[model samples]
Target: MKILITGANGQLGQEVSRLIPDASRPGRNEMDMADPGAVGRTLDEIQPDLIFNCAAMTDVDGCEKDRNSAYMINSVSPSVIAQYCIKTGARVVHFSTDYVFDGTRGMYTEEDAPDPVNYYGLSKILGDFAVIPLSNSLIIRTSGVFGEKMNFPLFVYTSLRDGKEINAIESSYSPVNAANLARASVEVERKGLSGILNIAGDRISRYEMALGIARFFGMDESLVRKGNKIPGGIARRPFDSSLDISRATKLLDWDFHSLESNISRLDVH
Candidate 1:
């Protein structure tokens, strides 16, 4: 099947591209998501049977500072893509975040009502609503994603390597590996599944996650400090935005890796 992946240079996008090497991977220069007309034009040119929209403005604090750019990329761009897919009979697989839920509740189910506390989450929630109604779409909400690109675990690794102290939140989350998420996304599309699904790693606290990485790499765990409260930032974070992946496990018959296991697999220096 013909496939197109937007934001092919991003963390998740790169992993998805690796999984589907034959898929058309387009960078911002080829198709700027900020311009809906440009995106539509690219879609028309490719005429892909399926489109994986991995493009997103994921900088949490940055989104708080620039809400317009966040909404445009997170909400409007996906809406435009969904509209075009509707007209062209192409299927869409959009990635979403666990931030859609308020931190007061952890282990969020697909049926749970979303109450985003930050602008980033609000933008993603809006994007989710826009695409959810489409008959040919799969909105996969994942959490604390890590990949070859710089992420939470990588930040910890680099900091420790430089002999600098790191402060990790005690907040809990289900950190999914980008490679695993990419694999599951393809499986969902191949199985002709539709609607929302939660694909993430086992639930664990941020501090524990960092500490585990330090321990695995034989680094000084003491350097990884446990933060009691959410660090001061432009955005508010969910303390327990961990998602329940029971549906994904049952439907895909796939087992998600634990935080340590996923970290151990990383080839970062």
Candidate 2:
């Protein structure tokens, strides 16, 4: 199958590229998602059978500071891609975040109404809505994704490696391994699934997740401090944005990797 992956530099995008080695992986230089014309032209040139869009303005505080860029990348760009795909008969698999929910409730089902608390969440929700009407398009809502790239777990590991004290938030989330998420994405496409689905690991708090990482890397857990209050940032984060993966688990017949297992699987230091 002719497949194209955008944001190939990102953790999830890199994992997807690894899984689909033959697929066309385009960097920002080749296909800048921020430019709608460039995205459309790229789609026209590749004419891929499937497209995986992993690009987004993911930095919450960054989004808060620059709402224009946030909406442009997170919402408008995907919508542009979706429109092009609809015209060309290409299927799309887009990645979204748990931030779409306000975190007032945990284990959010796909059917749950989204009430985003921050600009980042609002931007992603707009993206979700943008592509929902398109045929053969799927939006996977995940949380706390970690992989070889700089993420929560990797940050914790790096801080410990430097012998620096790290403060982890008490906020809870369902952390999905990027590799597992990539695998699930392919599975969902193969099964010809459409619409929204939640693909996430078991829910765990930030502190416990850090502790697990410490144990996995044989690091000093004492260096990891528990942060009771929300970390200072321009944006407000949801307290509990864990997603219920029952649908994905049953549909894909795959069990997502636990935090410890995910950590052990990583080859990076």
Candidate 3:
């Protein structure tokens, strides 16, 4: 099947590209989702059977600074793309976030109501809402995703290599790893499963993840200090964003790897 992958350079996009044998990767130059006309033109030209849309304005802080850009990329663009997919009879695999939940509950289910606390989360939730009603779309909500092209893993690697102290949140929590999330998305598309699924890793806090990585590198875990969220920050993250993947297990019939396994699989540079 002819497949189209948006955000071909992103963490999840790259992984999804690798997962597909020969995906049609559309870079920003070819089809910038931020540009409405460009998205339509690309959809018309490619006419792909499956479209894996991994592009987004993911910088939570940056999104706060540019809410218009975030909304355009996260919600408006995807909704427009979904409308095009509906016309083209293309199945869509849309990447989303666990931030859709407000975090009052520790483990979220697929049926949970979305109450995003920030502009970034709110935009993603809008995209999720837009896609669910049309076309064969699979919405995968994940959190703290780390990968070769990710910022989080790079921060961890740089801090250790530079011998600088690192700080992580002991209170906040979620599962993470871009490659694992991408793999799950590929499997969902390959299986033609359509619904909301949580592509999360073994749940743990940022502090625990740091300690685990430090341990992996034989570094001093003490260098990784636990920190709390800044008071009155623009984004209000859920203290615990762990998602229950029982539905994913039942529907996808594939077991997700543990956080330790995810770290072990990383290149770590």
RMSD of each: 1.5, 1.6, 2.0
Q: Whose lDDT is greatest here?
A: 1
Q: What TM-score does model 1 achieve against the real structure?
A: 0.95
- Which lDDT value does model 1 have at 138? 93
- Pick by lDDT: 1 or 2, better one: 1
- Candidate 2 stretches greater than 4 Å from native: none
> Residue 58 deviation, candidate 3, in Å?
0.4
Decoy 3 TM-score against native: 0.92
Rank the candidate models, highest TM-score first. 1, 2, 3
Residue-level lDDT of model 1, residues 72-152, one tens digit each, is: 889988988898888988899999999999989799999999999999999999999889999879999999888877888
lDDT of 1: 0.88
For model 1, what is the error of residue 140's alpha carbon versus the real structure, in angstroms, after optimal superposition?
0.6
| Residue-level lDDT tens digits of model 2 in 41-82 | 888888898989989888999999999989888998899888
**Candidate 3, poorest ten consecutive residues by summed lDDT:** 228-237
Candidate No. with top TM-score: 1
What digit string (tens of lDDT, one per residue) describes model 3 on residues 139-163?
Answer: 8878777777646556776687679
Global lDDT of each model?
0.88, 0.87, 0.79
**Candidate 1: clashing residue pairs, number:** 0
